[model samples]
Target: MDTKQLNYYAEQDKILIATDCIIFGFDNQSIKLLVFKRRIAPFAGKWSLIGSFVKKDESVKNAAKRVLTDITGLENVFMKQLKVYGSVDRDPGDRCITVGQYALIRIEDQDIELVEKHGAVWYDLDKMPDLVLDHNQLVEDALVQLRLKASYQPIGFELLPEKFTIPSLQKLYESIYQKQFDNRNFRKKIIALDILTKLEEKDKTSSKKGAYLYKFNRKKYDKLADAGINFKL
Candidate 1:
């Protein structure tokens, strides 16, 4: 139904309010974005964000969560709605207002095989192919928000593995900031956060002496971050 025909009681329930997701993943090497091919509908073969219509008795967040479960098969993941795209021609099907959100999930639990069944694929932000509709703009907006988020909060947890090395952290930060950092200063600043505890054992596979790994201490960081302790590196 178009937006014009939604006022009556019976027609109101049929109104479409959809949600599109910009799911982000980290590969320890570089950041990646998740996109899916349009299996059915207006743009049959074009790449697009994972999306679904708002369901009965479901809130906007619930609709997004259902999309996550239905498409990715991952639950209790990190997600937040970025904005709503309601351009008259945004969705060719009808007058649906699409809520665009960006989600961060651990790569290990990404269910790549299951999602691939729908032709869902991961693309590097720098080298992505042309997307359908305004989906590309949605992704750009989401990335800008993620970059800002990484500043005060260690949003990298959504991307990084459980146990990571200082080099891994540095590289992640560099990818988000798009700049090279002096290793010594980088370590100094990140260590100063006091949220990462050095492990006794090192990752020997990478080298002979190996690099010491660190784990994020969420309990401690939350307490400090609450007190407005700035986190930067």
Candidate 2:
């Protein structure tokens, strides 16, 4: 170890880094964002995104994953880096920068007790409360990224269960886009994609006649994705 080099580097300014997650889920109707009330000063009791400071041995992605797991108790979910927010006054607590990450998880799959323990609440994306410290901007950017990715990838499936009706799937898309889609066209396009496996079972809850249940074929989607197929819907 070079003592001189260590001493010289020790004089540099130290900046704190944090990872804030924009967690999205579908509740069979609308897309929801998970947030909790701030527990500390400078915005205490205000809505804020779940986050954690990066540990010395962890990367920003890992920190974000840790935050997600702590809050939701689910892992290996769809997560992506949205952007880095380094505005000088973004954090009033300190000179800090935050790496924004967005994640998609099935609403029914999260740990309900854990969420309650942290005072986390799910708010509809369109009706979310104003978040603290530039967190609202983070949410806006994440939604844009989500819509763009859903246009080309089947990533929206992450927010759904294993088996779902076509109508329910259509509802999920409509909630994401915040608009109505033609029922016939949506069904036709989804079937043409050939990424779903039609099951013999039917979901009778939605209707007396029942709608056929389908599951997303991950292997088939992987092959199609590798073949440069686009899932624009």
Candidate 3:
């Protein structure tokens, strides 16, 4: 490292970079978001998205992953960058820029102890409370992105259990899109996709005539994708 280069870098302005995660989980009925109270002075004890400052040694994606793991104790969950928010006055406490990443995880897969330890609570999408800073905007953007992605990609499987019934899957899609789909059409469309394997085991908890469980076949979906077949739902 040359002294001239070191001097040039030292003269540059320093700004804080952060990553905020909008975690969406499905619990068989509706989609929910994970939020916790902000511990900082500017908005202490207010509802806020799970977030962390990007460390000097870590990328923004890793920072988001770290925050997610700290709260949910899960790894390799489906996550994607939604947007970067850099409004000059978005944060009153400091000149900070946040990269928003949204993640989908099965609600049953997370470690409850870790979630509680971090003071996090899952809130229904429709009844979410006011959040700190621009988190509300982030949530709105994430929901839009989620619906868009789910329509063309088989990403909704990330929010479901290993095996789920067709009715349960329909409910999941309805919850995401906030619309009711014709049962026959949904079932037909999903079956035509040929990405689900019907199992003999029945989930009898919902009814006496139980619905048969189905598991998503990721390999089949991947192969179809590689063959240029589109998944539409």
Which 10 consecutive residues of model 1 have the lowest summed lDDT?
Answer: 6-15
Q: Provide the lDDT at 116 for model 1.
A: 77
> How does model 3 score by TM-score?
0.96
Model 3: per-residue Cα lDDT over 62-162, one tens digit each: 99999989999999999999999999999999999999999999899899999999999999999999999999999999999998988778889999999
- lDDT by residue for model 1 over 1-233, one digit each (tens)? 59897656774545478889999887777788888888778898888888888877999898899888777889998897799888888878777788998999878787767887877887878878888888999988998898888888988876788889999889888887778999999999888889998898788877899999889999989999889987666
Q: TM-score, each model?
A: 0.91, 0.96, 0.96
RMSD of each: 4.0, 1.5, 1.4
Model 1 lDDT on a 0 to 1 scale: 0.85
Model 1 stretches astray by more than 4 angstroms? 1-15
**Candidate 3, backbone clash total:** 0
Model 3 deviation from the true structure expressed as Cα RMSD, one decimal place: 1.4
Question: 1-233, model 2: which lDDT tens digit per residue?
Answer: 76766656677899999999999999988899999999987899999999989999999999999999999999999999999999999998999999999999998999999999999999998789999999999999999999999989988999999999999999999988778999999999999989999999999986799999999999999999999998878
Clashes of each: 0, 0, 0
